[model samples]
Structures are given as structure tokens and as C-alpha cells.
Target: MSSADSTDAPIYAGLVEEQGDVLAEVRRVAEEVLRDADRAIDFGGVRSSAAYR
Candidate 1:
């Protein structure tokens, strides 16, 4: 089973949470990713030069 599958599973996130410093750093990184995703430009439908569609 995966870490998130059950509480008995060995989870890296659990280890991080047990350590305050690592968990805080992880939270900071996650927040930055969320912020970047919010501000990100959507070029999804745009065709690239090499892509013929």
C-alpha cells in the first residue's frame, strides 16, 4: 500500500511532519508552487512551430 493508503504505511510526509523544520520548508515550497500555478500563463491551445495540428 502507498503511504496515503493507510496510517500503517511508512510515509515520507509523516516523517516530514514529525520534523518541524522539514514540514515548514515543504509548506513553503508548496505555497510557492500554488502561487506560481495561479499566476501561470495558459498556452495550452496555442500551436507550436514544430507542431502541426
Candidate 2:
């Protein structure tokens, strides 16, 4: 099947992240993992907020 054919597919993904016991850091770790996985992408820089007009 073509990639687009799977567009409606659903995934069962989850994270078993725990800290200090796991730092319990949620967004931080997720973003780090995303960056590592997409090393070719330059996320530019941290953005606080954006406005579209």
C-alpha cells in the first residue's frame, strides 16, 4: 500500500517516562527525543508564542 493510503491509520504509542524516579519531565524529554530523531531538521530556535494574521 502507498504511504498516503495509511493516512487514516491510528497508532498505539505511549511513553513510560518516570523521573527522580524520573525527573517526571514531560515536554522536555519529548522535545529532546523529537530533536534527536530528526537530527537533519534545524528546529530554528525555541519559540514562546506565535501569532498568525
Candidate 3:
């Protein structure tokens, strides 16, 4: 198979979670939380974990 064909399959192919709805929830949290602070974390602005709370 070509490299392009492999891209058609899931990265977690054959895993049980890959076939369920759990990944959707994971992506949601990642986008909401991680993506939000990604910039500050990169610039060293977030100094403490408590800042998140």
C-alpha cells in the first residue's frame, strides 16, 4: 500500500477505543483546556499549576 493509503486508516487503528465515542470527548477536552493555555505555556507565563484553578 502507498503512504497515502496508510493515512486513510486511523492512527490508533485496531484499538478498541478507536472504534468508540470516547475519542470525541478526549478531543473536546484537549481543544478546550490544552489549546487554551498552549500559548502561555510556550511563553513561560504560566508559572504554577494552581494558576489553572
Candidate 4:
């Protein structure tokens, strides 16, 4: 049988579910860093003039 059809599919699915928490944490960290960077660029006038167009 294919890997997807094997009995281990349930175990693999559980493993994937367990990763959701890590994924959420990673997303939160990335968003916080990006928000800080955006604020700096917005207030520091570091963006390119062409971006205003």
C-alpha cells in the first residue's frame, strides 16, 4: 500500500497536529518582528520615493 494508505497515516496525522503549536509560535514571532520593522521604516522615512507612487 501507498504511504498515505498505510496504517501509519494516523500516526503521521497526529504528528502534524502536534506541530500546530510550534507553527503558531513561529508565526507570532515573525509577525512581531515584521511589525517593528514596518514601524521603523514608516517613521524613519527610509522607504524609497518610488513607493509613494
Steric overlap count per candidate: 0, 4, 0, 0
Please write out the lDDT profile of model 3 over residues 1-53, one tens digit for every residue: 89977986665565545566667779898898977787556745455655787
RMSD for all candidates, in order, please.
7.3, 14.4, 9.5, 5.6
lDDT of 4 by residue, 1-53 (tens): 88668988787678779766566689999999999998776744545665787
lDDT tens per residue, model 1, 1-53: 77557775447556756865675788999999988997796566465733865
In candidate 4, stretches whose alpha carbon ends up further than 4 angstroms from where it belongs are 1-20, 43-53
Residue 27 error, candidate 3, Å = 0.6
Tens digits of per-residue lDDT, candidate 2, 7-37, equal 5333211123221323346767988998888
Stretch of 10 with least lDDT, candidate 1: 41-50
Q: Which ten residues in a row have the lowest lDDT in candidate 4?
A: 41-50
Ordered list by TM-score, greatest first: 4, 1, 3, 2
TM-score of each candidate? 0.39, 0.29, 0.31, 0.43
Q: Model 3's lDDT to the true fold?
A: 0.69
Better of 1 and 3 by TM-score: 1
- Looking at model 2, residue 37 earns an lDDT score of 81
Error of 4 at 34 (Å): 0.6
**Hey, what RMSD does candidate 4 come out at?**
5.6
